[model samples]
Target: MYYKEYGNTGMKVSAIGLGTMRYDEQDVKAGRFEKCAEIPLYALENGINYWDTAPFYCDDKSEIITGIALSQVKRSDVYVTSKTNFSTLGDHPSRDDFRRRLETSLDRLKTDYIDFYHMWCMLNLESWERHMEVLYSFFEEAEREGLIRNIVFSSHMQGDDIETVVETGKFKGMLIGYNALNHRFRQSGIEKAYENGMGVVVMNPLGGGMIPNHPEAFTYLTEGTDLTVPQAALRFVASHKEITVTLAGCTTKEHIDDAVKAVENLEEYSAQEIVKQFEGKGASLNNLCTGCGYCKGCPKEIEIPKYMDAYNQYIFTGKKKSILDRLDNHWDISKEKVLECIACRKCEEQCTQHLPIVERLKEIGEIS
Candidate 1:
């Protein structure tokens, strides 16, 4: 397996890190710990040393099963990453509760310390501000007590929130949403973090399993080569020199094999070239928003990005039910938001892609 310098952390992480989110659902459902454990164990044998898991992944069995797997391997052979949701911060998280949570993770992983601990699901600056004072104290204490090697955060917010959080320079790393469809909006903050020498681990690099299904849509990434769509997508991310880890949340060995082969055969390509190709052909050139977030602060509090993502989903896969389900269930974006648009052209005016925001809203209303 290939390795890359994990930014200022000074760790040589496997370029193909293992994300243990989908660890054999069938095996897990059957209560076959051994079968599920084989997944990470197989990944280790394949030279993927950066094993990432969380308490929430795999129906809250990820950390437990991953811990069981880690116990069999030499502790030093892997760098462990885990996260805490802490979305319940309004319940008033005491430091002891926080430490207990960390200790519980360490206990489950069968390791004394986590290599990277992420403040999971960090959205905007306001959300962080709500927990800043408490989190800062807990982070320092966790480090001083050797519970974590470095403090990091994971965010899905591609708006001004990401840049605001990264510029503080308080984190050792960040895990943000990065993929072919989403990169344009997050690039600025990603570069800023890289500039500060912080490790950047990208989640949703496969567009949350959207790319592989629409392989034909991304033939442009192959660029006159015979690379498959997923291969092109993974290689495209590695082509960005600033990116430290392009996360593959694989559930199957086949999935790992695909990503491994993609990275193994990675050929440098121009991101601009790929994007330009998408703008014209080789990808769906529907009324797509680049996720620029210029249409943010909607007066009606509409989640325009969620709307655009759903549109892109339909355009990419030609699956109307999946698109509607994603917008409704996965993204939690209400179709009812269309009623709140107020016929405002404000979002259109601020759009860099100049997509038809009002028209899309009308179409979204007709999604049923």
Candidate 2:
């Protein structure tokens, strides 16, 4: 229920924004959006005003379901977000193509104007420049026409790359992946966005379901607190002053309630103090992979993300058997393939967290 000014937007967004990507598949496929739609309604009832969705989320029905919930509420009471994927637009994309996508999004959402319309999935500066080249003007035209209130982007690029994007001053806000496990990688980007008076919303605040799945691995965050590991994980991001909203992908009513309670009695914690806690008890926490899959395109064709996910299990249990089991049972990859790494450091170079990927691969080779 705690609200903070989203940068200098003059809008006080809820600390916990409802991320509408995780609706129940059965309900969604059965054309049962009314049931799944209740989740966001519950979130709104609990003081969440920010609802984020996209064209392709939840089998391309997330925006429709979110629109169902928005129908019952006054438009001004909620800040709605949706996105258009630049990659999906074919080569030689035109302004009309972008506008067509926007019109479709508006039709699906049953709303005339989106509070925040994003240039979705800016992977690097090159892609960002391409988006600017192809569709930035269309975004501006839409904004001037009152079809979108704010122009923003979502990225998973490194801190320096993100700073470069912010320096363009083209956006009012940004959504980036940040969590207890990988904050160091994206810290500079978050700070730079905030410094430039841009709202910074965190997308994968739960490490893409890794933290909640293995709560025991992050006990340090909950020490001396009444919060569960998930709440503590959420608070870890919400506690940062630079962050505007912590987007949680909620499915059930309980998920919405838990996200609400996590930020209801919000407490701001110093970045240094939170970092110190990690350094004291879990210095290696930052090395744990969130399975972002940025480390693909290995020249040797090694499944790097799968091995790193296995590494997470190893970190959690401190058991070599866990690593072997992870590779065999979950990833269905042989342990011997860990030796395929040529130490070329391609994956390392692309890693957002700057993890010692080669070193970890070597360790996995030795242990497994």
Top lDDT prediction, candidate number? 2
**Predicted candidate 2 versus true structure: per-residue lDDT over 1-368, tens digit per residue:** 89989877899999999999899999999999999889988899999999999987899999999999898899899999998866556766788888888998898888999999999888777778888888899899999999999999998788899999999999999999898877877888888988899998998888977988987778888887888999888988998888899999999999888888788678776565667657756445667888877788999899998899898887778787898898888989987887888899988766756679999888888972
**lDDT of each residue in 200-298, candidate 1, tens digit only:** 887767765567766776667788766688877887787676677787777777878877877774544444554554565544342455454657878
Least accurate 10 contiguous residues by lDDT in model 2? 276-285
RMSD of each: 6.0, 2.9
| C-alpha lDDT of candidate 2 relative to the true structure | 0.87
Clashing pairs in 1: none
Q: In candidate 1, where is summed lDDT lowest over 10 consecutive residues?
A: 283-292
